[model samples]
Target: MQITPDTLATLNNGFNAAFLQGFNAIGSQGNQYQQVCMEVSSSHRLENYGWMKDLPGVREWIGPRLINNLEATGYQIVNKDWEHTLGIKRPDIEDDILGVFTLAVQQQGDIVGRHPNELVFAQTLLKGFTTTGFDGQYFFDTDHIGYDVNGAETSWSNAGGGSGSPWFLLDLSRTFMRPLVFQMRRAPEFTPLVSPSDPNVFHMNEFLYGVYARYAAGFGFHQLAYGSKQTLDAAAYAAARTALGTQYRPDGSALAVRGTHLVVGPGNEAAARRILLAERDAAGATNIWQGTAEPLIVPQLG
Candidate 1:
């Protein structure tokens, strides 16, 4: 059934109700966290077991070494220590969905039927939030590899997700991550808006949120940019290209890192596109930067 006004109200009202008070503690007093969009290499992924897989340090098996073991002789891994083999523990971001409702209400003459604006407004909220991961606070987190009881690693690369999931690539090796992976684990169960304080009243469902990236110190400082200028230019594009070229992988080999996507806020989309999609070089005589990357308009970045 379609989401109705009452349903939207249910979700909205619940959101207005009890928020995760404790979760609010994040990014409130401590040092502010910044989400830097960098390139990440899919070649660096290793399906090692445990929380170690999510840890930045464990990603050292990049390049051709990752799957080369299977191609070689007698390649059978044997690790049967299940007594203390902990399950893949994802960061505690909660994904609480409001209860489903019926759109089955037929419009009786002149009653105006379901509120026409309700679904639209609801859609607005969702669309507004779709690219909001660029902002701070408990938002969508990247998924980690799950493991079996025998401590064997499970593939996250299913038709359902895994490799099909969105990610970036760093020209660098596996030891270093170019694009910071937003590790997350959505809550397995959901609670409909129900009142525990008082059974008669509907309570907002709990939407828990928590996300963590690696140490900010890991970020390559020189790679950051903010010229003493106002608008995008070929010089700026050239600098970005040069910086992206420095991304390295775990094998200590240089990766083919290219910006490929110049994501910008709605306000900056035009300017960013002008630099990236220009038919002629914004700086040099050639159209070098043109088509090197597309301008991704993410209004939320604003």
Candidate 2:
């Protein structure tokens, strides 16, 4: 993405607010939270992923992304930064100590408040716009979507090659999961402390907050063009064009998929511009998807 003033302005204005809310919901530990943590025993796993070996068509199911709870807390503090400033300060100055205590309370909120942001960003950085086959795919209904008819490792796809992307027809819109679901706790609220005589100390009550969110960031229901193949060339651009028409759910139904969002890494800025800003197609034909999709340049997508 461009680091120019205008580019940065666009990013600041159009950053992912949905994802942000999924990460941080302030004052929510009492009743609202972005996500929650669910314990998984060795037997209780996060998800099941289907894979097939090229060697002998050996199929197997593997573990998918796991959710864990992390603890974040605000610190307790009471400060007398200007205790000796009685003459240097006003006589009826209780707001200084109380004000510092109030600020400390805000810090406490930030401590646990930022974990969801950190976790979500890390996950996105790791798997945004991936092209592998269900490498980290998670599904609400493993029985339907995540499950495949590979004969359970005893079965294999004899259809020439493994399944590629969905081959959907036009106008039939496909339904997709809302991307992420964060389960969180509303533990309690923060309380402050103040002593009348000893106005030097500020304190915040102890509390905890966390989430167990599911992140599914695979590229559509199937893979199209990605990796080095996604240059701004004819084939690469065709893959994107194809996705507009070819996207779908697993049931062989058309999603009538129309994408207005464009996700690209910093490296793809030039290429992305070439594709998104084209007045015509590569052969000077009428651009079909042009002016419809807006680019969301993400450095983490690199």
Candidate 3:
């Protein structure tokens, strides 16, 4: 193809089409982050998660309605820039070997499409033991503070203490909130720098293409997720579920969180499947825990 305006435009259009094709293909089928994290749009470089605290439940109407204020928790998620670039040597297009470059660009789109899974599962959830949530405590901690029925400061936990491969039990029943946040400042855009006059095109003798995106992942409500490094056995799974269900709100009421998904790494996929799918246990006893929660195996977690 000649390096004319029309040809450059045509090349970009074709590459963009391929990019979308690849993106849509994987975005719909391979994304697991949406199962655990809620996507929230960000208009600025950083978003303050100050409103994560629970509000007081409605009480009997007193002389004046109790005005509960949402105090800032100082938890924030900052959107970070991300990009994946692919350079096609000028000779490739001139030689009509553009098919390979098209696939390469499409692959870049696939990478962008799956990036949220990396941020949520690989980075955030995998490191949840050390990562702080909105409550200014590690997302999965034993001493998460809450209030009791008497308005007394009480401690609750979302972590099951054990020294083994980490697994998570997430309460995704809430529609408006989740245990994790996916903050998107900008959707991915695929752009090309193929103009003949462009310095990079002239000097590098290649056409540059890239996908740019701005996003970040952070912990949301700690009550919605429980992480256990304990060997993912029947006892551990049951314990985690019980802990999540017994969480209380700051207003000293039942938060009523329930574990809806069982997240595990490749290392524990077999055990997780046995626990959730098997109709009978290893002892030939009925699998009472069957269908408790759906099993999600995240490759990145391994």
State TM-scores per candidate.
0.34, 0.37, 0.96
User: Cα lDDT of all candidates, in order?
Assistant: 0.30, 0.32, 0.87
Per-candidate total of colliding backbone pairs: 22, 19, 0
lDDT of 2 by residue, 1-302 (tens): 32345643433232223223333445444211122112111221123323211112322446763332332222111111111001111221222323443343344445435544334323422332231233232211112222123322221110111122111111112222222222222222322122223233322221112122232222222322222222444445455555344433333344344544444556666656666677787688876656655554543335
RMSD of each: 18.8, 16.7, 1.4
**How big is the RMSD of model 2?**
16.7
In model 3, the clashing pairs are none
Best by TM-score: 3
* Predicted candidate 1 versus true structure: per-residue lDDT over 59-146, tens digit per residue: 4656754342222212111211111111111111112222221110111101111111121122221232122212211122122232
lDDT of 3 by residue, 1-302 (tens): 66678888998999999999888889543788897878899999999989888776767897988888889989999999999988888888888898788888788878889888988888899888997888878889989887677667788888887878899999888878899999989999999988888887889898889889999999988888889998999999999988888765656778788899899989999999999999999999999999999998888888
Stretches of candidate 2 off by over 4 Å are: 1-118, 128-176, 187-234, 241-244, 247-251, 266-270, 278-288, 299-302
C-alpha positional error of residue 43 in candidate 3 after TM-score superposition, expressed in Å: 0.7
Ranking of models by TM-score: 3, 2, 1
Error in Å for residue 21 of model 3: 0.6
Q: Weakest 10 consecutive residues, lDDT, candidate 2? A: 79-88
Per-residue lDDT, model 3, residue 205, is 93
Better of 1 and 2 by lDDT: 2
